[model samples]
Target: MSGVWVWVEQHDGQAASVSWEAVGLARTLADGLGEPVTALVFGMNAAALAQEAIQRGADNALVCEDETLAAFRLEPYASLLSGLAQERQPDVILAGATTRGSDIMGAAAVDLKAGLIAGAVGAELSDGRIVATVPVYSGKLMSKVTIPEGSPQMLTIRNRAFAALEPDAGRSGEVETVAPVLPEDEIMSKVVGFEAAEGEISLTDAAIIVSGGRGVGGPEGFEPLQELCDVLGAALGASRAAVDAGWISYEHQVGQTGKTVSPDLYIACGISGAVQHQAGMRTSKVIVAINKDPEAPIFKLAHYGVVDDLFKVVPALTQAFRERLGK
Candidate 1:
């Protein structure tokens, strides 16, 4: 029978947070569809990991294990997963819009001959159909799309758009193994060396972000905000203005072309809040703007606004937070 299935991605046997996030989103969708949430785990040592789906609210977890599956491989994963979906006839399949997730989704979509939607932020299950919300035109626009005809409708959602769900101890289920899943010889992609990023937490995963822009004067001006961010246990972010002006690295930029963040709190220091910048962080739970010009567009969307020099105001705010949070 058809149900909501989440593709769990793991790295070296460790579960990816994006998979848990997908499980959370799938649980909501399943609740609306009045169906069960089943996570599909494909990798080695999956026995110890199946409990995650149940603890996180999945009704059942479908495990397909292999030693070769310990690493990500586009060819075998796409072949195996799409083949399974065809056999099981799931109502819908959801995955994170991570680089790797998007790769697998695209490959599987072609094989399944199914309609695909990327960067979905919202979903609704009603009238025996799944309607997905997707952003368009570099996030300048948005639209709702539905698959009129498909056995397993597919969608990939932007990370952090949905809040991660806490484990629900009351909800428990079983882990079933999908028979004859994949063999090492059948897998095409092989694991090479991994260059893990060091000493930097990406803005996409941060809960709090302290961002600066061209108005911050120069690259050196970001120091104070960095200090504040460090004290706040937050990540550093930059506007396109700062990045374009060569004041900050593109990796630090938050915009349509850069990373999109829906942090718990987003503090903009001297940023003018261009459309692109807003596109990235407009969904933040709480927004604070520290720009001298009250006329700046940033204040229009900010929950809190200060019309003063950021150099003076930001330090004061930082001190206040440090005194309060003792950081």
Candidate 2:
């Protein structure tokens, strides 16, 4: 009756990477709390995903399968998950702060009357209760929070905030199927279509990222950055300045108001390193900055820095990487 639960979000019959990452964190929490880690998977073909959950660190899995649950419709999915929470009475629940995860968790919180924390960067047990460290004021400060007594603690973590558990084929666990109890009238929304972005890697999932800023000069300035990204097999990112100037699409922007990324390596070209911009990518493993201004704040955060014109430095760096990579 008392356990840590993770919501496994899946897409195209495959589990999302963030869901695996959450399971890894849940494994740690469950161990600390001396409880089992349970994964809740919901979709049309969720049994396979449930197997993946066990391999990725879950002690057991609960799968809910139905045609209406295939594509994420808020009402039915929330109703099923919230109903399960009421019946199973899990102690803590964790989910990724993705579009689908956020929507479903928010609705479930309302249905179960649970205390919810959004965008938690870290979580651990403190004196027999779950405490989470959450970002506030655009990542300027972190606040530790605990759910009130008599409530199931729920948390939504940002993508890439934690490392994923490596899947092991040798691992095994139990899987239980839960029938969906949805009335036709309760399912109000339907997903008619889904279109994926063209020729772009997800920023949060990319190991390497090449980002441009205002000093890139114009839209054409991104050409060199793109070349470097291509050579490194990296995603392309932009600062809010470049995005606001119409030099790049908003989808490519990395900032407080934009997407957050935690790549293994991040190369910032001509970016001044505003607090808002840094908030999104500061978690990256290694930061490299190239700019003419030696006084730029980005240098403070960069592990490696070059004080030179980005126009010249970027192309030189690109050509050097191309040769080194045998591209």
Candidate 3:
């Protein structure tokens, strides 16, 4: 049990992509520490996910299955993880920097008195200690931190910051079912229903993103952007200004206040990049900017840029991609 552990987040009986990514990183860390990688899964019928975890590089899967654990409630989940950590004394725990992951991990860390690193993009073992690199100052700086000696290190990594390992169906590992230690009354919160979002790929999982800004004019302006996104199989993103202007939901916003995305390609249309917006997407592998203003700040960070009206440029680009991709 004194090894690396990943908290696998699942929804609708499927594991989150970030869970697999964390497994990949945990495998690397476990290899360096000469320890086994264990994945902790919680949900009803979570046995399948435990086996999936093994195929994704985990040596062991610790599953907690119960009707009460079907939906994610903070207290029960956090208490369960804390109890396990106290009993098993894991060397390191990794979780995705998602809303639920951040909440549960912080509570568990407080209970275990462990060092927690949030929004970590990279990690390594140095001098028998786990060191994590986290972004600071709107992604302008990276601060490296190490947990105190003899304490379990807890880290929440950003989505898309690490790649997931390919699953090998032939791989096998141990799966152990564990019961929750929390009392019935201790589980205070209850989930009554679920609501699904409209059709759109999550920005974190998207390989390509098409984003718009104030220059998009209004909510209607997103139409052309959506068309372009559809053609390229990309997600639609919005600058903070656009979101604040009520042109789009905050979920699609990308900035310091929004989600961080490191897609393979990012297309900024009519956006005069602010530092906050760039901080969220500056890590993208490739960036293309289209703006009528040649002095737009976004152009400085773009690998390719075109100074023109987006209304004309975007449609043309969409048509061209559609013709070439035949989609």
- Please write out the lDDT profile of model 1 over residues 171-254, one tens digit for every residue: 778888875456777776678789876576678778899999978999899999998988888999999989999998888999
lDDT string, candidate 3, 57-148, tens digits: 99999999987788888888898899999999999999999988998899999999888999889988997678888888778788997886
- Worst lDDT window (10 residues) for model 1? 179-188
Backbone clashes (count) for model 2: 0
lDDT over C-alpha atoms for residue 60 of model 1: 91
lDDT, candidates in the order shown: 0.84, 0.90, 0.91
| Each prediction's number of clashing residue pairs | 0, 0, 0
* Candidate 1: residue pairs that collide: none
Tens digits of per-residue lDDT for model 2, 109-199 = 9999999999888888887687888878777678998895855689998877887899889989999999887866678777889898998
Estimate candidate 2's alpha-carbon lDDT, on a 0 to 1 scale.
0.90
Model 3, global lDDT: 0.91
- Return the top candidate by TM-score: 3
TM-score of each: 0.91, 0.95, 0.97
Candidate 3 Cα errors over 4 Å, as ranges: none
Q: How close to the true structure is residue 288 of candidate 1, measured as C-alpha lDDT?
A: 97
